[model samples]
Target chain A: LAKTTQPISMDSYEGQEVNITCSHNNIATNDYITWYQQFPSQGPRFIIQGYKTKVTNEVASLFIPADRKSSTLSLPRVSLSDTAVYYCLVGDVSNTGKLIFGQGTTLQVKP
Target chain B: DAGVTQSPTHLIKTRGQHVTLRCSPISGHKSVSWYQQVLGQGPQFIFQYYEKEERGRGNFPDRFSARQFPNYSSELNVNALLLGDSALYLCASSLIRVDNSPLHFGNGTRLTVT
Candidate 1:
């Protein structure tokens, strides 16, 4: 499993864009970068996933540089309801069931 | 089309006691995984089962064991529990064991050891 490092907490106001970066220097060639959002007292929800380049969905966008050693999750026009803990995981999702989650980045969306 | 579901949303047990937690995966999902989340920390993988067979096990002690039924439901059992066992037990399900198939998680069962 690739270890990931992220900010412990981030603060942002409504309508602003929030970007959280994760560093996985030991990422493997077969590993894919995935992000999940967890609200209080709830299970974490999948946000976006990518192997390289950029991938976007209705909720967020993931940008993986050419090196693939790091990735950033970009949230557009943040709102108070978007406040949650964001986790970045890198692994071979297809081959293994042991998905490792690190101490996620806590995003505080202020009103 | 319900998501993964866990039973006994909240439980309290004493040290040296045994407890069982149950989970029902989404319809048609064949893989189920269990995780333990301590307060203020990310979830830790405990076990994973696919088609009623154990696919992976975490670094947890033997006191923690799990089994999957033919219907793809799962049960996580803990024996001789300690205070450190208190945490949220989460169950996640996926349709298959391939690709980037994202896991669908349940609200989790909160266990408190006294």
Candidate 2:
């Protein structure tokens, strides 16, 4: 399993864009980058996933570089409710059932 | 359709005691995975069961064991628990045992070892 490192916490104001970067220097060729959002006392929710390049959805966007060593999760127009712990995971989900999570980046959306 | 469901939203146990936690996967989901999340930290993988068989095991001790039923429901059992065992036990279900398959998680059962 590839380990990931992310910022412990980030601060942003409402209506501003937020970008959280994750570093996985040991990422494998078969690994995919996935991001999840978790609120207080709840399970983490799937936000976005990408293998390379950029993948965008209604909720968030994932940008992966050619080296696949790092990825960024961009949240647009943040709101107070968007405050949560964001986790970045790298693995080949097609082959394994286990997901290794790091400490995660706590994004605090303030008004 | 209902999502993954776990029993006994909260539990309090004493050291050296045993505890059983149950989880009912979503309809048609064939894979169930268990995780333990300590406060202020991310969740740690414990076990994964697919089609009533053990698919993967984490670094957990033998005291932690799990089994899946034919219906795809699962139970996590812990024996001779210690104070460090206190944490939120999470159960997630997926259509398959693949990582790409999005995991549907329940609110999790909070276990407190006194």
Candidate 3:
């Protein structure tokens, strides 16, 4: 399991693009970086995932450098509903998919 | 398709008592994993079971145990519950073939220990 570090919280205005970066200096070669979002009283929901470079989906985009030591999740056109806790996880899914969640970055989207 | 479902959405127990939480996976998922989420903190992995076998175990104490039935449904048992045991228990299910497929999560069971 690769330990991840992220900002404790971030503030964003509606209609703005918000990018949250995570640092995993000890990422293993087989480890894949994944991001999840969680609202109050609910389980974390999958947002996006990437191994290297950039991967985009309907919801969000993931950017990983060649070193694979760090990654970022980009949310476009934010809204108050987008305000939630975001988690960055680096682990080998082939093993058990047992994710170790850190104190995620709380994104507060304001009007 | 229906997402993962957990029973007893809210539970209250006293110290030194026992409690059980149940989860039903998606229609075709064969893997079920359990996590503990405390207020103001991220979730902690507890156990993972695949094909009725234990696939992974986290750092949780032996007081916490789980099993997956042939149908892929799972049950988590906690004994000697303490106040610290109070937290939201999450159940996630996924197919075991692909390594990168995302796990579908249920709303979660909120257990409060008194």
Give the DockQ ranking, best first.
3, 1, 2
Report the number of the highest-DockQ candidate. Answer: 3
In candidate 1 chain A, what residue range of length 10 has the lowest lDDT sum? Answer: A91-100
Docking class of 2: medium
Q: What's the ranking of the predictions by TM-score, best on top?
A: 3, 1, 2
Q: For all candidates, state DockQ relative to the true structure.
A: 0.74, 0.65, 0.77
Against the correct fold, how does model 2 do in TM-score?
A: 0.97
Clashing pairs in 2: A93-B99
Candidates' C-alpha lDDT: 0.93, 0.92, 0.94
lDDT of 1 by residue, B7-101 (tens): 99999999999999999999998899999999999999999899898888999999999999999999999999999999999999986756768
- Interface CA RMSD of each prediction in angstroms: 1.3, 2.0, 1.1
- Give RMSD (Å) of candidate 2 vs. truth: 1.2
Model 3 docking category: medium
Q: How far is candidate 3 from the true structure (C-alpha RMSD, Å)?
A: 0.8
User: Across residues B61-88, which tens digit of lDDT does each residue of candidate 3 receive?
Assistant: 9999999998899999999999999999
Q: What is candidate 2's lDDT per residue for A1-111, written digit by digit as tens? A: 999999999999999999999999999887889999999889888899899999999999999999999999999999999999999999875554689999999999999
